[model samples]
Target: MRADAKKNREQVLAAAGIAISEQGVDVSLRDVSRRAGVGLATLLRHYPTREALLEALLHTSFAELTAKAGELETSSSPEEALVSWLRDCTAWTTQYQGVTELMAAAIEDVESALHASCVALRAAGARLLTRAQAAGAARADIDGTDLFALVAALAWVGDQPSLESRADHLFDVVVSAILTCAPVLGDRRPTEEVSS
Candidate 1:
């Protein structure tokens, strides 16, 4: 690709990301082109359709997430690693909207790059979950597929700003239930009264 063409392509991807994050995946290619300050022909040259743009965005996001996961190397116990992963996942989920919708759409009867990325993400997440379980932190009964579903559902539920408090509550509840340790009963604080 020529220098100008490469710049145009980058602009289109950036515009598409913002459009999808703000408007939705259904945003028109013309709007994306305008957002990129490029002609519609140029936008189409890089991404043939809305699905293609969405695929590009999803691919980038998933790749970043997988890379982050791969870099997670805490010397803490399995529970700590699991908690760190969960916190990272939650923060990403809270920041990105419509990600699950795009992912679900990608898994349809369409052949696209997004499918491959999703598969990779699932495999990576499963590997992490397995390690965590082997170290005796997360519940043995839960698998990666379950973790994926839980994260997706939790993201949707916690997307709202007001729901943050509820999200934290839900997180604690789920974490307590999924951990192999003794249940944490409410908030444990040292008693101030001296029995002696």
Candidate 2:
């Protein structure tokens, strides 16, 4: 790419990131162009579609998540690593309004520009989940796709105005359901009873 073209691309990517973070993933391309001090044509020249822009913006984050999974595999307990990564994924999906839905669609459409990034993100989560399952911390029946759906569901709940306050509780409940050794609710067994 030419120097000016590259510069314009970088500006658009930066502006899009800020706009998406503040206004949401659905922010208009015109607004992103204005923020980048470029024309709509220029923005289009760099990223032909909104999904293209989002893919560019999220490329680094996807790469980092993949790298983090590798690092966490050896650095933390399997369950801890899986939980931490799931939280991170939830935060990432919820960072921009509507992003979780966008990613869900992207992951299913090979033609979408964001598909690769979504796949990478799922692969990273899969690594952590595999480790957890191997350690008997997570349920073996749940796969990476299942975990991704759960994260997206959590993010979608967080996006709702009425349910936002309960997102944390919902997250805990969902995670517990996915864990093989999670304590059941109101299970007043010997473990919960005071032994005489």
Candidate 3:
């Protein structure tokens, strides 16, 4: 792609993210073009259809998330990395409820960009879960599929308008449940435990 075209595409995706968050996935292309400060024709040139635009947005978000997880692999502790990644994941999901809906649509259709993201997310989650388990700080029985489902459910919970105030606490509970051998209640860190 030309440099200008790539920049325009990036702008459109960024604008679409905000528009979708503020309005919804059903937000019109004209609105997205306005938000992007681009002509509708240019926006259409980048993403010919609403589904195409949505798929690009989802793909971008998922790629960023996967990259973050990969970078976190070098963290001092797998447990901390996992918790941090989960928090990031929650924020990403909550930030774009439209993406969640798009994903669901793709799953039902089974031939959308969301389907590709599902595969990628599962692979990334498996890597994280495996690392956490290897560190002896996460449940071995919990598979990537289970974690994916959990994240999806958490995203839905986070999307609730009424639950907005309690989102952090809700996510904390999830983290607590997933963290094995974590200092519980009033217990102090084990004397020989490696610090995170």
Best by TM-score: 2
Could you give candidate 2's per-residue lDDT for residues 99-172 as a string of tens digits? Answer: 88888999999999988888988998998999899999999998999999999899998888777766777777
lDDT of 3 at 92: 84
- Give lDDT tens digits, candidate 1, residues 1-196: 7999889988998888788667656788999999999999888888887777777766776787777666664454566656666656766665556776666555553585577887777666677778878878667898877777777767776776556556666776677777778345465332342378
Residue 156, candidate 1: Cα error in Å is: 0.4
Sort every candidate by TM-score, greatest first. 2, 1, 3
Of candidate 1, the 10-residue stretch with the lowest lDDT total is 185-194
Collision pairs in model 3:
none
The C-alpha TM-scores of every prediction are 0.80, 0.86, 0.79
Flag the better candidate by TM-score, 1 or 2: 2
Which segments of candidate 3 are over 4 A away from where they belong? 1-7, 104-110, 183-196
Return the TM-score for candidate 3, rounded to 2 decimals. 0.79
Best-performing candidate as measured by lDDT: 2
Write down the lDDT of every candidate, Cα atoms only: 0.71, 0.85, 0.78
Worst 10 residues of 3 by lDDT: 183-192
